[model samples]
Target: MGNCIQKTNRVVLGFDHSSGNVSQKFSRGQKKDNNYEKGNLAEWQKQKGFGNVKKTMNPPQTPSVSGCLENSHPKSHPLPTPNPISNTCHRGHKKQPSFLPLPKPEAPPSKHEESSSIGTLQPAEPSLSLYSSSFSCILPMPMSESEILSSPYLKAFSLDELRKATANFCENSLLGEGGFGCVYKGWLDVETLTAARPGSGMPVAIKKLIHSGFQGHNEWLSEVNYLGRLRHQNLVKLFGYCLDGEDRILVYEFMPGGSLEKHLFKRNSPSLSWARRIKVAVGAARGLCFLHESKSPVIYRDFKTSNILLDTEFNAKLSDFGLAKAGPTTEAQTHVTTRVMGTEGYCDPRYLTTGKLSVKCDVYSFGVVLLELLTGRRAIDETKCEEEKNLVNWVRLHVLDNGKVFRIMDTKLEGQYCKKSAYVAANIALRCVNHEQKYRPPMTYILEILENLPSNKNLNIY
Candidate 1:
């Protein structure tokens, strides 16, 4: 790699340096810090907790955990529960699935009973309506996976099939604990969804939901609706899902390379090359671009490094569509108004202010992910100094304003990365996290810039 890398190096040489437009030069992907002064937070902050802007400094800690939504860490590589993933995929031949949504739903009351307790039941229907908040009422009728998923690519998996394939959920078959439960590695005949000889069958990851909740129910629906239907190289492949009785399971293609978060944050693992990081970013951006550009746009609500899984070759694939929703449409220019939900640091402030759900929210979250990729850190770690816990705030205050991109770049990269390329990448990330949603760059443009980074590899090297 050379001393400088620029896609169409839009890095403007002689501006005020602090001006917002400086970032627009490099592939026009720069987003600025959110002082939140420009936006009208009067109504938003007027609400109970939103009012006190002063007290807003990391109140109660948004918790670095993704709850049922966080997918990586232990199960990504199957190195047991608490071990850092081995650097090489072949090192231990271990793999697991931590990327599924929702456990089984609580059973509804039987027909002849007087409805007591906090339970509601509705008509069991075959016509699937995905937007239900409480699935207990609108129980899913027994339908084959192929029947439920309109797409020819997806199949319906049965509990028996999943159980047998996973060797009856044997401990040795366990991969890792995901959002709602444990993920197990299994071998099966894809055609039959039946247990096959260990090495003879297709290798797959099965997510077994342990607990259940209303939000988890909705996320599970979201997973089935989106992952089951959409197809893209950067998006993880969903072979099928299981909804038998109280057992809710998801089946996915095995990702031997594990999660991007582990590769970046886990100790003792090899660091990803600068080129590979760029490739991963480009792949993820392409996935987002595909979603946004799809016939029906999707908002990947949870755009974090942990959700980006990799194959043996280190090709990144976007996982956990449990948080994804359809993007705002032309008719809904303002935003798709809804309850505020997302990881704290990565959430777009504008969305919280307006209760609006727009594609821009995803852009803001992706910007945070870019920041994480640039600096190997968690979005929120209680152990970190109060200010540093929130990666966005830290980057904006330190790197973006200071223009010390070199200081912020992950030291784990050692001296392998190109400084100029690093600077440009930081600019791209800054523009992405800009407080104003409009200022954030679109994934399409972002993808174009990232895709061209490889050409600049020979330009900048430490």
Candidate 2:
């Protein structure tokens, strides 16, 4: 159901389904709509008249293209009713795959388009099915490594058990390759997230890291520490991890929509309209805002498209906490200075030079990602000439140019984005990436702008 991320270049964006996409109605401290917690998705969908699906033992099949989120609640956002399809998979396990095929690599940017980070899109990897269940799990930290075996959140798995679940790490189950190593798709119980036989429980993405890298171990521990400690609708759920001697693996709630990276940058994927992009931004912002607002604030050093995973409903959930750092607790201590660590293009420019970090550093990175969504450009595009390589610089210049804001937009949008929202987004992004960290708006302020973009300010075509 809505719990799994549709791994398509999908759901139209903004946590658009498998990750935590915030239902738009709630203000800070307000309770989420209880209707969203309804037990039977098929029953709820029928009552709401969503998707026009029929009642059955298995859930209805979801669509490849995630539907749009309006200035409304989950009940009000008109779902894209997909045409009916078989609800059962081979062995009768329910498989609701909503993957759409990608188009050819877009034509490389012409030299004339100097300001837009319009690098050529690459072909997406093979599509995989995104599975979701109605159940949700809670995390309880382990007291020690021995207690990890008993921890409710960080479950321990034996090498033999993991090997069996992943079918000895078969190549066919490979989901995607990255710097860390290979990620295989595996099966687990819906509630416990413990290993289960195929078709017996829910599906999960198992990330197996090469045994030796310091970064891998640190990142794995970081993910376990943060995701294990914090619980939020907009943050990815880390069900368990394995530390079997030389084998180190992390288990996460498989995000079928993959990363916001795939949707915004991959070729052949359906384009994210203006509204959806705004939704995704707000969703990610909520996750960051939660961290900043915590009793012990956390700075998510890496806030980029790749780390934002989407669920089946295109709800955005923040994943990968390797770079998250606790903020200064005392009011007298303004910032925490440390060795700089972050993605190449999305790092806060001030943090990069000063090696001094603050909650605002995250705001800066978020500004970069926001610009990416607005312009459909990479933060750093080496393909572009020296002058146009930096997205923020280029966008900041163009955003200030009256009547030229469209020059920074993604061409694939086909002029369908809301001009007013796009302009507001650009203004926010500009403020976020300001050279001086103090000039950046707090995440809460950013949240307000995104939430009210379509409604608070009059909507005018760009």
Candidate 3:
């Protein structure tokens, strides 16, 4: 390993860091203007080529949460009684009758037995199966709008409060925009949880939904349902939500360091050091591990660099739960069939080809993110040559060769990381991106490996 590091260092020193230009440079995946102009949803769908599938893709009416939509004022409306038989999909699709529902597992023996500290470095007991009946007590049932909004962890913010906090959503307050809507930097009073004067209150990221966008009220509710109930150190904190009339919005704790994507791929931004990179990887792994280990596991369908937000200390938190889905409930169930929705390049090929979603699909995407951290490259870089455009393919071609493994290391790292540690990290990433979904290790195992990597000094290169 010593000799290999020496040889690789010389070659790395001569490698050009500024050869290819990043072609697509958006803060988020794709940016849309925050124009609030009303447009016809049918025409918009037609222009986007969704006319052919309009029948199957029509948004299902959400009677459970429609009561809040009727009130335009900020005053608290009476909580509407939930529908007795509301088992509709989180996305606006009606539940199909073709699939039979599985029997619910009996409650766990004790709540204390199932609980574990998420912040700890130790892995869970290996004897406990992830899908065993003991863990079924945590499976989340379909939540009603009243139950979702009434979560003690989440506050119900009125539209008027958000408007005042964001200075009426002025251009200067704009943070960033994506397919769902625009996020603006806003201020809120700490103790009272009310709108505060700019520069005088705690900062927050307010996401206002776009009515015309493909994503709408359903996605908003999905986010509220998940983030409002789930709380973890590595998960982004949802301050509250607004559902006045057709206006839909979510308020989140502001991340000072912004996204990992900006630091890793954006030009002029400071490069993340080797130690900071490892820290970020571990933080993100912990977040994913927490989700997987939940009594009712959750599959974060969309796990990408842009969705990993960092705080002032660079602690990573998973954001954007709109596309999140609940994992299989019973031990007999291996996967859940759902619509394929995730970013390209980072998406699992098996999930993309067969709409069977599982926790391992997230592991595959995590591998892509690990590759990005290792090589300082985008998962899909259109600017690069044909062979190098896909990061995973390029890695497979080069990483297996012990002599060439260092060549894929981010040039900005300046050969500062441990050579053996780098080799171990690379192998971990390869195992994650394995073509066979079952071959992928669970997030717990992955987190254990990452947790040990930063301090381990005796690892062999091979």
Candidate 4:
């Protein structure tokens, strides 16, 4: 009888005399030969209590097999049955006894269960999503569609808040009426909105957009764009704006004393004193100087008393910018040609005839204002005698002669004003009104001249 044995590192397989093959795993293919000899496999089976082990010719259709072999803290076979083979001699099974079954594993806790046991979780350690949420909280809320369209500075106001501040556009809140809009006296809710008076705790003038029927859109944009960016003591500040449907409005810091025109024309009360008049004229001159000599020169196209507004202290600030134009060139002599636009007596004759506007145009208007200040007389009075009426012609005829200068001085001044300073001012006014625009001194020189004039009002009269 013959016996076959195959040895591996930790396992051994043997074939009996009756089997043709011996292996640790089962296969579907049938064995080609059956050995005729009976060998030591019988002796191995008997000693292991595996009696008369024999090979099967035909394998089962579905073989019970394991993908991998493992161990329970030690070496273990992949056989499904705990003790499938009692002896190795029959079909290459191991000689030792199989191990015991493994114990079942414990299940893990769920999210809800874990939370309940541990306590509330710290907000899912802020991820990118959390950062986005935080940013949303800190960022300003978006304005409505109407506000976005109408207000150039949309960040300044909301519709509902402005409505409340203006008492829902009440008529009693009205302050001054004009072509572009009406100015209203109203208490702003500054506590919540930055557009309101900073910390004054009082009312402000709100210049709401009126139904002018004209193309005021450009004017609205101009005011917000320029005034929104400019901050100075001599410039009127634009506080905020509202864009609620068809109603577009702008708010400005109120000027209690109103415009210079009201005082000059005596629309409200008696004319201003000579001292006050000189102060106002100089203040207005300084305002124009700032506009003309700024880093980028700004020419006041509509330079007149009406465009000058007076604050609580009677301090003058340039108010209207709708017609203000930037200088054409860097040279002080640069002139720009445009359609004639300005009040009659105040308009520069050269600018009107040649259609060429320049800083000199502003200079000419200032000359007229200076005349108003010195004589307390209207630039052109139709009611006065022909020779005495037009202020420019009157000044031209009288300024060179000293005695005629005194007669032209405001009677209200009563010879109680500074004659030397008044003469200096009149000479400056003459230069400003000179027929040749080139002969006029620059505003800086004019400012220097005015500054050097003594401000002592108590000096003895001429």
Candidate 4's residue-wise lDDT over 426-454, tens digit each? 76676676656765656655554555455
Determine which window of 10 residues in candidate 1 has minimal summed lDDT.
1-10
Which candidate tops lDDT?
3
RMSD of 3: 22.8
Q: How far in Å is the alpha carbon of 276 misplaced in model 4?
A: 2.0
Please give, for residues 67-113, the per-residue lDDT of candidate 1 as tens digits: 21312222121111211121112223322212121112123224332
- Off-target runs (Cα >4 Å) in candidate 2 are 1-151, 401-403, 455-462
TM-score for each candidate, following the candidate numbering: 0.67, 0.68, 0.70, 0.61
Which portions of model 3 miss their true places by more than 4 Å? 1-142, 401-403, 454-462
Summed over model 1, clashes come to 19
Per residue, candidate 3 scores C-alpha lDDT tens digits across 179-264 of 66799999999877799998888899999989885457777888888887666678887888998989899999899899999999
lDDT string, candidate 2, 345-431, tens digits: 777656655567899989988999999998888888877986578787677445443336789999878887777566667766876
